[model samples]
Structures are given as structure tokens and as C-alpha cells.
Target: MADVILYRWSTERDTWVSASEVEEARAYLARQGITTSALPDGRFALAGESARAFGAERLVFLGLQQLRGTRSA
Candidate 1:
């Protein structure tokens, strides 16, 4: 399964607020009239007023992949 995560960059705190659920992220984006597109790297990109509406400087989509043939530290 793909581990999809959404993050909004907070300029004030210089950090990010994340949503683990794809549905939640989709709803939030829809409310803000934002749209997402799939990238070639298997990640998503946000467009439109998401940053301003959410009081964030940027919005990012993160797709987590497990490292195969690697030992967990």
C-alpha cells in the first residue's frame, strides 16, 4: 500500500502540519478550491489557493516508500 501524507508548511513556526488520511486532505483541498495532480515521481502536487486559505507558505504531498533489503535501525 502507498503511504500518502499531506503537509502544509507553516512560515511562523517554520514547520509543517501533516494529515495522514488522504480523504481528510482531499476534503480540505476541495474546500479551498485547490486541485492536485500526480507527479511522475509517484507523488502529488497541489495547486490554487491552498497555501493562503490554510495560512501556510506551501503545501506538499509525501509518498513514503519502504526501503527494500535494508535493516531497520
Candidate 2:
């Protein structure tokens, strides 16, 4: 299956954190010899055994962005 990259906009930091969870996952995968590539615009590409090992995954993808005075999740 094709790799899916999730995205989320951080209101606290006020920036796009692409594949945010992937980074954390990569750390563990790295120990097992997995390779990950961070793409432009906060995206990530994962390959090798790590991808297969950490294959089944779920992501928040993105939270709503609220205008000043507006609320979003």
C-alpha cells in the first residue's frame, strides 16, 4: 500500500507540523534500522522495514484552525 502522511496545524506553535507523530515513531524505528525522509512543507516519507513494521497507523492529520476569537479543535 502507498504510504500516507498526515498533517496537523499547531495553534500553540502556530505552524504546520507535518507527520508530527512520525518523528516520534521514527526514533523507535531508527533503532531498528528504519529510514525516514522529511519532505518540504512539513511532510514525511518513510521506507524500508520500518514502514512495514510501523505500517498500521492512525493520525489526527489536522485540527481545525480558528480565527482570532473563534474556537477550533
Q: Which candidate is the best by lDDT?
A: 1
Worst 10 residues of 1 by lDDT: 62-71
Q: How close is candidate 1 to the true structure, as a TM-score?
A: 0.31
TM-score of each: 0.31, 0.33
Cα lDDT tens digits, model 1, 1-73, are 1221212223353344344444445555555555765445444556752343221213323212121112243
Leading candidate by TM-score: 2
Candidate 1 global lDDT: 0.38
Clashes of each: 0, 1
Q: Please give the lDDT score at residue 73 for candidate 1.
A: 32
Per residue, candidate 2 scores C-alpha lDDT tens digits across 1-73 of 0122222233343333335444555554455454555545444455642342222132122111111113322
In model 2, the runs with Cα more than 4 Å from the true position are 1-21, 47-73
Candidate 2 local distance difference test against the native = 0.36
